[model samples]
Target chain A: MVESKHSWKAWLYLAPAIVLLLVFTVWPIINTVRMAFLDDYSGLEEVGGTVFNFGVGNFIKVVQYQRFLDCLKTTSILCIATVPISTILALLIAVALNSIKVLQKFLQTVFFLPYVTNSIAIGMVFAAMFNIVGSFLGTENELVVTAGVINNVIEFFGGTHVNWINVGSTYAANIFVMVVYIVWNALPFKILILLGGLQSINKQYYDAAKVDGTSKGRILRKITVPLLSPMLAYVVITGFIGGFKEYTSIIGIFGETMGPADASGRLNTMVGFIYDALASNKQGRASAAALILFGIILVVTLINLQVSKKKVHY
Target chain B: MADNNIVVMHERQMNKVKTASKVGGVAGKVLTYLFLTIMALIILFPFYWMIISSLKTLDEYRMSVPTFWPRVVMFSNYAEAFTVGKLGRLFLNTVIVGLVSTLLSLVITVISAFAFARLEFKGKNILFAGLLATMMIPGELFTITNYGTVTSLGWKNTYTVLIVPFLVSVFYIYLLRQNFLQIPNELYLAAKVDGTSDIKYLWKVMIPLALPTLISITILKMTGAWNSYIWPRLVANDGVHSLITNGLRNAFTETTGDVNYPVQMAAVALVSAPLFIVFIFLRKYIMKGVSRSGIKG
Candidate 1:
């Protein structure tokens, strides 16, 4: 009898969360899959209780869209480029931080400063850094204005200023700016996790290595890397998941166009594609694209797990 | 005599080795500090740049060559950004959404976590597992449908739209549930023996024990609200319901399609200030919350 009473009380406690979750979480997952299969089901049209036929037309349409392909390519490229670069850099920095005795806390705090920052705000700052102040009026009659701070630095180093994130800016230049920003944003969390992992490691392992007169490089390569593998794996997996969802940073740097002037949507990612679809009231296509992105993330995560299983020391 | 000579030679070699290692250690320490300092400056450079740019005159900002420091310090630019951006309104909306959503979410999280941790509910394990499974699915999937749901429900341009859809975070529930489980069950049993209700036991004992995690959750939730962009941009982009981010984004652009760079920078600086202050003061809670979630923005 007491057990039954407790069960009822538990249900009462769970009532609010359950109701919200049913509406927001459970229904959405089912609805995303439902809408993905529907043939161009507009949310606005659904208000009239229009019965839509179920098919894979939405998915087919999304796949055939060139911009969607471009989004996939951008998302993949970003994930491929930023994850390993940030993870390795973070590892090196964390190991260096662990070895140091002076100003370690101060440096750690400084490095983690970006973690608390608003990305949109910081993206604007970066945009200013790489932004050109003057206008490009005509094809041949280009008005030379102030190059951004970064270009100024390049000019100082005897290198010509490259047009970055401007009209006629190369895809390579835009991607470079984005890679720098993403890596900068990614570093702090990776460092924190790895540093926490490093601290928990047995000091006696280092003591033994010291007594053995082991070279520092050798010890790091042979001992530190293995012990730190689990944290590294976690960081890499999460980095990829986060990287695949890249959207707002582009908005911050390039405004809602998602790219440089006159090259709008050139740097659009999967999430951006879905947003565009949704804004155009193409719920069917948006849901299809969302499912596709989810599928990609799931596959990539599984691959990460398999790879880590083989390679991770833990 | 030969043995004594060998001993002296060995001593000399050892001294040379010791000095070399000592020099190597010092050099390594120097290199470490140098690397850290450079990295620190690089990490902090954007913030430095944001501040200086915010202070620069428009003419100086647009000069053919960038000025490292502004020739004319424009303190008035802040005032301009503030009024033009309607930052006061945005700040109020953000605070209202952040505080209301956080408080409500905390209540839901606590009760749900209590049920999961301490109660004898049927299918509790399965229900909890179902919630955890939702975490793996990218949030965009839900967002697409939620947008439709909210729009159909006539929740546009309302605080209810911002707060209601995101009230029950599975991660927070899981986090708090883990925290609740750490408390000894004997306390609950004793409370029960004394005819204490579950809610009373939760308030007096469980909440106090889990105060740190609760604090962490509150800070994270509030910051999450403050930093939210895409959702608010979609559902509530009008002047009446605009959040800080969307307001700042379009606030300083002129009719000619040119952004007033310095004023925009000022707006961004003002927008970032509260978060920076929160971080400096409640950094432990924020970090704890972040590390626990392992979810990056």
Candidate 2:
């Protein structure tokens, strides 16, 4: 390619972003790959040496780690469960909001409120809403009650009172609480995006259908559903991507512990597990886990792009 | 007489149908509003609960049946949050980090966006495409190595650790670049013919044209800094250095004694109020920013 004469000035302008990107993004990725291939780099600093095993040992260790597997399962369950539920709910909300004449902006602002608040802070509120704990330091730690609205409803429906937060053999109840929180948190953005998509649709389509005396359900199915596919795809892809990295909300509800401890006392998500590994000087394992997560995200995103290309109307 | 009677009957039937449809229209509007109001209440309830719980006393907060509103409003809880949780320091730290990083990041983003948009350089497309590819990779991957780099640099517990890594966002650069491209190249050429420097032309002309996108970036970046928890918690989750979000993790909890849930809720409320106010007032900018990112709706 013929280079521009102004390449010098352009480089000057691009220097800051390039430098920061190299340090923070590019170099870190290279380092992660290198570390993931090697053994743990613990104590190498003191010895002024480097570890270079350069095998699949780290990957093997990551897959074999029970906590990592559990964390992956938890993450997958959350992603699979929340993404569709939230997308459908958001789509419905958006369609309703779009049809409305009054208080649309007001409702929009209310929905978007969750997007602005810190996840951890809101997670705390959600955690408290789901359970009523006994007095701190009380010997009657067993005196915990189902103070949360959802658990109370469950109790009313002839279901036994369960510690929703501290999930035991039944992971369903705990997963349910997590899904609800995530769905609520995810709604505002998805709704906003879907609303935008719905609004972008031309009025002529609806008018033509109305002239033909098309029912509301038919109009939505024939007109709204096809046109809104692009946004719906976008929401699903991003939502799934976000769901995989689930960390802070868990921390918000369960403190730094992430969730209620299992038999091994490991309540980790994918990101949380990575953080824990890195913190505890298990650099190789952390890097491997991170790289695995990256691969999954990349695959999921690519698959979504491919699927949407076939399905999305525009 | 028969023809006249048929005409009257048709007219009556048409009028009745019109009246039924009119009533249905009114009912539909009412139903729409009813649905919206219920959803709005559900969406807004957590924020309401946060504020009310903050105002309740310890006993009221832990009641067998939660009160919809506080029995007694504890205004002192706010004061207690400030002093007891050292929220004043956390607020200051958060504000400093947010403002400084946002301003610095803006400078980098504007210049880089200008280069990619207006300036023609070798491999410009390739470089930009490479950067775009990085967006596909989840950011958690970077934290793995960036944490090690920061710790090695002895930047832990320092503002440098908190602010430096995140000061450049590829997405923001891409957004500003798109915005800058909309400004005609003729203006830049016209200024260049006058012997104006690139930086001078940028300051005097490009910035004014792209002011809306610039404002969007600033507000979003600031809000991002305000809401950041995990990274800050990882590197600087210590006294004075802790961000407001990280600081609230367990600041109001009793270390070895009874925990006052109300007081902690008060701390959360304190941390949340600024963002809520910002969201309310500058919502247009935030909404516009998202819409402009080519992800409209």
Candidate 3:
């Protein structure tokens, strides 16, 4: 190594990223890990003075918290529903647009617009849409001013006017809307990568399939999809990881009701729960909840990496 | 006659196969268009509503029949939001945070990426892999410690809290490193022979070649900083100011009994517009970074 060219300057350039990561990322992470065990928020004990210290009580308390279990379930449910559904929708759009001759770029732009928009803005809009009265497309609200619009739609469905956010059914509805927003947000990425992978497949395969009397559906399943599995794996696992880390919409959707609320509430995500605990200054509880959420996501991500490395069909 | 019949039979079979495929293909196309239209509506409706709601007047927003489309378009909602929240200053703060952090992060990551991808050193692979694993560690796990650290340093309500903590992004480095590694090793060998040191070689050789990746990563950084709700919420969502999300949230809650929907929508639209423009050109990179980075920010 010493015989190699002067590498002294490399460290000089490396110093900034390293020092900041150490000070900001690594140190805070270490401190957070330590805080997870502590019971009280008053302050932790130190060797010479009052400092944050070790306690196992918070972890024990986290396990017993009903909201923890609820959040874990909600996150899993959200991911399970969103990942596969969104991927297929995105893939279908990609393949269709890819197959077309004109309007491809225009359609792509339309589909990809939501992801670029601020989640707050998007969420605010969705909230209004979900609002019975002021919502844009929803027919349940009193507003559409068009006498028969919302009423007819509701009557058509054998239902009455109902609030999308505050109703008893808002839990599942909330997750669904959030999934819609997230999937829309995540679609362009999935579409682009999948498109890149799609284009990479040799035209020879399709030409050969035609010669062999294989149908388009057969080609899609046996060729296009299998060939695109690696990209699919990439999207799915990342979706799983990204799904649980939500914030902007949830806060905007159900403003500050994430705690001690009934079923139709956001007492379902660790991120929401952390906000809930922190709101009331229960720092210890927040730390405990944050640690649990961290552990779940990290484990899933690690599993994803390992699984994709083994099973991705690339 | 037998040979003709055989050839005709083969042609018939092929036609059958082709026709069978065509039926499903037509149905699939119809369904695909139907689904795409629905999704397109879902995707575009909220943005459309936001824009319209921003233009809606206060009375129209609160009327008996909800103004689906504002009857009398009031452009003042945005004007009011802009002035009320000191939005120009907030925009300046946001731009400063986004651009500075992005450029700083890019510069830092570019160097580290070269080191990991090309530089041969003790524990290089271990450190790089460890960094990837660290990417899985959630930011929430670190926020408490970060808060405490920021407060103790007396950096609360200061730029340090806004900028310093986020200067290094593991995900960005990972993306850049992967792009860097794709460059042929022979180029480095060539540079070495010319007496260009590794750092200089990286600057003079790898950086120029890897321009696209850096550009994409910069866009990603910009978008991430622009839409950062939580960190700003934690650090700046209080007495003096909060960025877009905070401002919107305050606006949303301020008119509690009245809940000025138009004004809040106006604020939301205003904040979202800048990055929305950037999204048009950087669409490719933005999608790639967000979807495939595997390392979430």
Candidate 4:
């Protein structure tokens, strides 16, 4: 009330953004929530057929689906593995970059290169690389393994030749591929954020610690971790949230990554599962799966918010 | 006796420090090189693969033996990708969408940021908060409604469907807002004292100051728009006005019948090549753009 002078103009100035957001973002959210409760989400076909029915049907169907539960578990496991590893690695990179003054920007560029590349094309390339006898870097592979350090590991294990995209129920195998791709994709931005957190930390704090005869390890553990908690929290919450909505790189039910046995069944990623279901042409079940996914996302997001509020050291 | 014991303890601590730093240092050096090389390979591998693979004949493609540099590099794959694929139209479609969306986001973001930053308006905080809250919501949750609304409005397969929905980004708005907020309050006050209106102050002082950030945001959005996949797939009825990404996808898939792997790879390389080149220059701005989010993660 006190700041009510000429309030009308702000609305005018803000109109375009507000209007666009409503049409694009805000309104869509409202529409999704409403549609989630309805029975007829088989996408506008049979136009007069029970459009937007307000009932418990979609939820019931979603909850009852065994695939939905499997997807939730898969997505959870994927996030659990990806988040901690990526976060830890990003922190380490940030710390190292902070220590070395030379090639700092160059290193940042290198680490982030994967993130800027076309993910879909990468998916295609990964599909090729993991295809049993796929060529390493499109070169002549005269032997079972490429002439690198990892060749020894393959030899030591008496490796059975395997198609990475074939095995349908091997969670570990699928997760391994996903982890590699996700981590590579995630490294750049994660490195960038961690670098930011490192920047915000005053060098004076480190100097004070040095003068106190404190070890570098002790200084990092005491001062650095606590201070960067907010940023780390942001990373973790958004990491899971982002993963849950993932669809771009994945080939859906028909995929180069998910080979003949439909290895996508082993994926367990929530978004992947829902997307697979949707792409399978079972629109009702896909909608049900999508709704279930939405609920899982909502619950996890709530937990993230509560935990962040409690622990983020702003 | 005390001196001897003190020396012994000091040696142990120093050794521990030396060992720890050595281990961490070696690990750091190894990781730094390892990460840089592996990431570089991973980033470069797809394009490298695309180019070499595209040069190979079908016999080379389907052969039991893996040919590294292709038996003979053929440039015809590029010509063939353009001719057989009708990839040129797809390129134009993506260009139109990318340009339109970027221009719209740039204009709207500038105006919105100005209002949020300079105006002495009521409920400014509330408006900003509402906008920020939208950021936390996963985009997919709202996608269903967007698809339905556009369908209802007869906007499907039109430029409106492709361009209108992404007119303003919350992320960009926030970026611009932060930039606008940094201008000294006196600058705006002086403009007002000189009888300048809100729009003029924005057009002259704030916009000029914010142009660097704005250009960076514009380039980023253009890349995002051009690279966009799922939304366009949903909006496009078939491949009528399909972008190159979608075009390559359909070509590779069984929908269009026989797909030449070499040609498909060529198309992919063609579609993604511009961004790959542009990123060479835009790399710095991306660091600027992503630093805010990346640092915290």
Candidate 5:
């Protein structure tokens, strides 16, 4: 009777959150699936009381679209390329920071700086670093400009300046720039998590290794990595999920184009594809694309979990 | 005598090994520091560049070789960026949205958390599990339908649109619930025996005990408002309702397709200042909130 009395009061307390969640979250999820199945469904037309046939038309359209394929490819390449590289780099950095006592806190704070930054703002800063500032010189408007800081640094190192995200830049070059920016943005949080994991690890293991005269490399591989596997798995799984949804970082660099001016949609990811569809009022297609992305993330996450379960040591 | 000689030789060999190991350890430490210093520089360079680039003149900024430091520092660019980007208005809008949404969300979170934490609710376990499951689905999926929902409601170009839909963050509710549960059940039971009302008890005891988590939630929610771009861009991107992130996007590009790099950088720097300040002052809370959630994606 007491518990029953509290039930209604609990409902009262939960009313506001539940109401908003139902409208905004639960309904939206169901509506996304519903809209995805509705062939050629326009939200505007639906509001005007137009009935729509339900079919696989939207999914078919999303699959057949060339831009969507490009988005899929871009997303996959980014995920594959970035996750391993960032994970390894962050692992090494975290381990190094863990080993050292000198300036450890300072370096950790510095490394964690990007975690607090606005991605768009930092993305713009990255864009400027790689951007070529040009001026139209003659009547023909031949562009003359200064190389960006990245290019200047390359030249200083006796390498030629490459057009990174500019017009006429190669796909590989553009992807390279995006990878660098993504990795830079990703490092701080990973370092934070891994460092925390490293710190919480017992010192007895290291002391035992030292007594046995174990080499640093062997200890890192055999002891440190196995102990830190759980955090690494978490980071890698989250990294893939985040990489699939890569949008704002691209927006920060390329504005709304998602690519260089001459090559719009070249660097577009799955989320960007959905956004483009929504922007054009292709709600059904956008929903389908979003579902596709969700499916991919689900499959990937499951695979990651399976692999981690087998390989991760406790 | 031969055994003594063997012992002396063994001791000499051990000393040599000890010296070698000591040297190796020093070298390892030096290498670690060197690597960390370089990584730190790589991380910090963009910020340094953003500052220097913001201070340079347009001509200087466009020079074939980028200047490590601006030859002529342009202090007026910040003023120009402030007016040109209409940063003041954007700042005002962001503050309004951030505060209103954070406060309202806090109330909802506290009450909902209390309910889930203490009150014997039917279907409580299922409801909490369902909420946690939603964290797996990408938020972009929601945007597709929510855009339609908001548009049908005629929420375009309004602060209400910006503040209302995001008022119920399942993550914050979950975070606060965990915090509320940490308050000993004895206190609640004692209050109940004394005929104290649940809401009154929650307000007086639970909230004060869970202040740290509440504070963390507030900071995280405020920062979320500051960093949010996608949803706001979808529904309320007009001049009046646009938040700072959307406001800064495309604000500096000229009609000729040339961006004013210096002024844009200055605008970015200004836009980023508050977040950096918040981070510097409230880093512990922010970090605690982030690490606790671990679902930022």
Candidate 6:
């Protein structure tokens, strides 16, 4: 090894990245922690207040805010619902793609399309697709899924036509749309990763199982799942992390207001809540909310890591 | 005669098993193809809808039962989308920001990666570890305070605000450093023996060897710039400075609150065209880069 000595040249090379990190990343980390404890940093100038406070007032305020609590609930439900579903869907699709011999590359490209497109733009398409009825409250056919084809199919199949994103509608419709979007959006990268993992697994296991006349289901359960566990663990962790920050897709589907403008916008996630708080001069509360989100993510990730250590293969 | 009869009977049973398995295998293959075809249709349906909707008239788009394909094929919607939505300005702004940021970040990422991979420095391991740890923290934490910092700096609605705050990606740095590390130490030593300069070796040898990864990083970075919405929306939602994603929001909405669906779809298609093109052409790089990083991590 060329054990080069300590040199100013290395520092020169590192200075730009390091400086940017300090100003943009490192400093913000400190500022978040500092601001989270303060009561009213955004309004300090008007009140001539100090920026430092060791009290837990900001945290208390965040917890006390009804909207913040609702945002947390919304965020949790979306994450819990979307993550597993997307992961499992990705796994199944990846396995299928792996098993097939013809047009593998073609199918893979089609599936990966969503990963590259702008989420918000595609979200607009979804909004339009699910917007059956197009503001005509009463229609000739009460059973029609008005704005798009999805509802028409639902109606054609003897299912009741439900409003997908109407302000007064139940959470079921919103959740169904969000889940479909998230899973579709999430599938590409997960499938790509799992496909790579699948390819890397030793084929000898399958061959050996075949020689022993093992059933396909048994082979997949006993051999394939364990080998793909590492990738599964990766997908789940990243999915949860990405799911918690589910702001843009909502914006894509609902636009900048984050949900239907008529009602109080019931679909706000934690990040969206923080952003709203910041926008509305609730910087102290926003900081507290951000820190709390950070705490939640860290705790969840650590727990995931612990679980993966036991369950993940290699 | 009895032994020969037993052998023939056993051969017949084995042949029957082979035929049954072959039948099952063919059925399974058919099922796989059928499932893939259906899934592909469902997956690509939105894209299909986007295209046909862009060709629709406002009236057709609002039809109680939407047409699978546009009736009149109103291509004028694209013109309206281009001019009315101000997509030209958005595209120019996005391109300028994307190029400037990607170029600058490339420089920073390459140099930093080189240092970490090849150079011996005090506290390198600890610094790299710290950087990696930061990745685990959600970016929402940074946005909380970065918003204040940028606002205080008076950078609102500026190109600098769009490009600078997110330039140094630890993931890119880590990715490039891993690529650089794979180049054997012997190569560096051999170059040093010839009195080759570090910068020259990096430019001449290391970079070329790592071109695939660098290309991947560049594509990813630019795509990121194109897709970015939240930060850009938060800081630069001003009409003159907005990125395409933020600009597309309500761009075609009438004062009466009814969105011109056809025009909006046209605008989305226009905004999405470049990405689709990039995906078609450079997908291998994107997949390779992502998978490489995922596997390593």
Reference-based TM-score of each model: 0.94, 0.91, 0.84, 0.81, 0.94, 0.93
What are the runs in model 3 whose C-alpha is more than 4 Å off? A1-7, A39-55, A133-159, A167-170, A208-218, A259-268, A275-284, A301-312, B1-31, B62-70, B184-204, B238-241, B254-258, B288-297
Give me the displacement of residue B186 in model 4, in angstroms: 2.4
lDDT per residue (tens digit) for residues B118-175 in model 5: 8886799999999999989999898888887888799888999999998998888888
lDDT per residue as tens, model 2, B1-297: 999997687567556655756766688778878887888888887778778888988877766666778989998988988888888888999899999999999999989999899888879899999999898887778998888788889999999898899888899899988888888888888887888888899999989988988888888877777788878878886675898877787574321112466677788888888887887788898887875553211
Q: What's the C-alpha lDDT at position A230 in model 2? A: 89
Cα lDDT of model 4 by residue, B65-131, tens digit: 4566888787888899887768888888888888888887788888888778767686789878998
**What DockQ do the predictions score, one after another?**
0.47, 0.43, 0.39, 0.30, 0.49, 0.46
Model 1 TM-score on a 0 to 1 scale: 0.94
Candidate 2 lDDT (Cα, 0 to 1): 0.79
Which pairs clash (backbone N, Cα, C closer than 3 Å) in model 5? Answer: none
RMSD of 4: 6.6
> What RMSD, rounded to one decimal, does every model reach?
4.9, 5.4, 5.4, 6.6, 4.8, 4.7
Which regions of candidate 2 fall more than 4 Å away from where they truly are?
A1-3, A40-50, A135-146, A149-161, A166-170, A261-267, B1-23, B252-259, B292-297
Q: How accurate is candidate 1 locally (lDDT)?
A: 0.88
Positional deviation of B188 in candidate 1, in angstroms?
0.8
On a 0 to 100 scale, what is the lDDT of residue B109 in model 6? 95
- Which has the higher lDDT value, candidate number 3 or candidate number 5? 5
Stretch of 10 with least lDDT, candidate 6 chain A: A139-148
Q: How far in Å is the alpha carbon of A291 misplaced in model 6?
A: 1.3
- Stretches of candidate 4 above 4 Å error? A1-6, A40-46, A49-53, A133-158, A167-172, A204-223, A252-295, A305-314, B1-71, B254-261, B293-297
Per-candidate local distance difference test: 0.88, 0.79, 0.70, 0.67, 0.87, 0.82
**Error of model 5, residue B211, in angstroms:** 2.0
Model 6 clashing residue pairs (backbone):
A132-A146, A132-A147, A133-A146, A133-A147
Winner on DockQ between 1 and 6 is: 1
